[model samples]
Target: MEFKEVVGRRRSIRFFEPDKPVEREKIQVILETARLASCAVNAHWLRAIVVDRDKIPPDKLNQLKTPVAALTLDLAPVHIYFFCDLGVVKRIKGSRLRELVDAGALAPTHGWSHKFVDEFVYPQILEPMTNNLQGYLAAAMADCGGAAQNALLAAFDEGLGACLNTPNPVLTKQVFDVPDDWVSLWVMLVGYPAESWEAGGQRPRPPFEELYYEGDINTPFKRDPGVVEKLKASKMITAPAPLPGRRQEILQLAERLNLPM
Candidate 1:
């Protein structure tokens, strides 16, 4: 599918085919896409543990589910838990940045060199930031979020359904044997959708003008109708949610799945 179409079609698919299984290759593609995402300082803090639904012990799986995501966890065939390693910056100590300099990606024209990293970047910048745990965690998590989004998009591009959910952190760590320095981010539940691909059409969002600004904070960016039309034509902008028969569809699905309406 076209990139725009893939973006358009992405939905937080909560209802998945419980009996179906996702292919290993598709899962690998999602991970590969995430690995290629841009990271600050090339620290590459993101890590993931993919769990097969059927293989997980039932009791442990139950413990891993959060109250809001209980049904989602039970239904998805695969669960990918994301984390950000807080120790990465301290461990690498700007070696990754030096590698970029050596490879010419971080060029001398940009004032990048091995000496620059060791002297100014590491001791002066990175070390101090790492010492302040809260500030350091926020930056690392932001980088992890980018990588997770890439994985999410890849899932849709591979013709699978996925949703980002908060897992039970205490149980997640215990069940997965997570490292002490690894902070939990999110769990992506993956499978084939039980509902229609449109998922009742595109979800709602705040008005574009309210969300963006131009040169001044008071000046809202003027949205061009022509560009909007172009995006709609390319399937990037789709119909709003709660399509016709949506309620009936949900009712039927509830009955079939033995879920309360």
Candidate 2:
């Protein structure tokens, strides 16, 4: 699809053909797209559970309806749980390590090495109580968000419709039996859109001038008229190009994930 068309068509698809099954291969394709999403210093910490009948909680599944709308979860062919893992940041080189080791600041040692891990890092990270809880949570949340958006757009590219939502986090934790260390960030329903009534036209977006900034938020950036016109005229609404090797990387990752039985 053209970029503009994809943008115009990519709506928060709520109504779907409930009976139809979204193929495993297609779902794989969407996930592959998400795998390519950008991250902060490649702190890849998001984990997703593509739940079908067996793993999904019965009671929670029964209550998955919105107030006025139809049962959104039941309508889709598949439901996905997006989770944020707190450990990824701990494994990577992040700001916390930098702050501790920078020359001016209180340094952990001469350099960040395995020796440092044995002396300073091991005692600090191994003890569950001593971890940087807040810092880890913040990094994990950001990583999860990037992965979520990747999944959403990948669905769009696959000619599938999807709705992303935040389910009751507490209930989700209990129902899915998620570990205390991992948090449920959100859920997304995926399937082909039902051909029914129009979901009132595409929602509004603040004119680019309002939302975007130049060097800072204080100064509104002016996009070139020709460039804007070209974008507006040609294709779907897209962000910038993702980093190279994203799709390939994600496909390799899918092999490691637990797919529905």
Candidate 3:
């Protein structure tokens, strides 16, 4: 499908064919696409777990409560659970630590080593505990969101469907056995579009100008209305076609994941 058509067709599909199983290799490819997503200092905090319907327990799925998340998690052939590793920040110490130590902060005679450990190392350890969990969460969320979006688009390119759904991190962590420091961010449900309706009754997105601004909230640019309409018609803007080699990379990812597909 063209990017425009894929974007136009992309919808938060809650209903799915319970009997159909998503290809294992396809799921691997999508995750591979997500893995390539960019992150600050190459700290790829996001860890995605692709689970099939049978793997998700009934009571656990019910725990989601919301219709969207429940159906998405329950009915979809595959679910990718996004997680963030807070410990990844420790990798920042390698080159940075050498620079800090060489800069005289670790001078043994002045007891700067003690000061360095106390001032920097201790603070790095305590920061997460003292600071707002929500703040750190938001940053991790933004990091995963890009990767999830990439995954969704990749699915569309592969002639599959996917929807980003909300899931309780508390429940997900327990169900998936993710470490305490590694928190659940969200869930992406993937499958073939099995609904009878075309595009699953999707509505038009809000006008681009109304939502986007130039510099501040007040300052607005005269967006090219025609461009949006054109893209909307083409489905390119909504579902951007994968770049060259993206699909191939996803296929290779299947090998790494060892998924059945």
Candidate with the greatest lDDT versus the true structure: 1
Query: Across residues 71-173, which tens digit of lDDT does each residue of candidate 2 receive?
Result: 5676677888888866655565454444444444434344564456456555565434227677667766877787888788778777889888887767677
* C-alpha local distance difference test of each model: 0.93, 0.66, 0.67
Measured by TM-score, the strongest candidate is: 1
TM-score per candidate, chains pooled: 0.97, 0.69, 0.69
Clashes of each: 0, 4, 10
What tens digits encode model 3's per-residue C-alpha lDDT throughout 1-261? Answer: 665676666666555665688888888889898988865434567888877778767786676536546545656788787888876665454344445456864466755464565476546653453256777667766877888887888887787777787688787788778778897777888887654224424555676678888879897667887987887667555433334454554455345433234
- RMSD in angstroms between candidate 3 and the native structure over all alpha carbons: 10.5
* Candidate 3 ranges beyond 4 A from true positions: 64-68, 91-134, 237-261
lDDT of 1 by residue, 41-83 (tens): 9999999999999899999988888889999898899999998
Off by over 4 Å in 2: 2-5, 53-58, 63-70, 91-130, 196-200, 237-261
Q: Which residue pairs show backbone clashes in model 3?
A: 3-235, 3-236, 4-234, 4-235, 4-236, 5-235, 7-238, 7-239, 24-261, 25-261
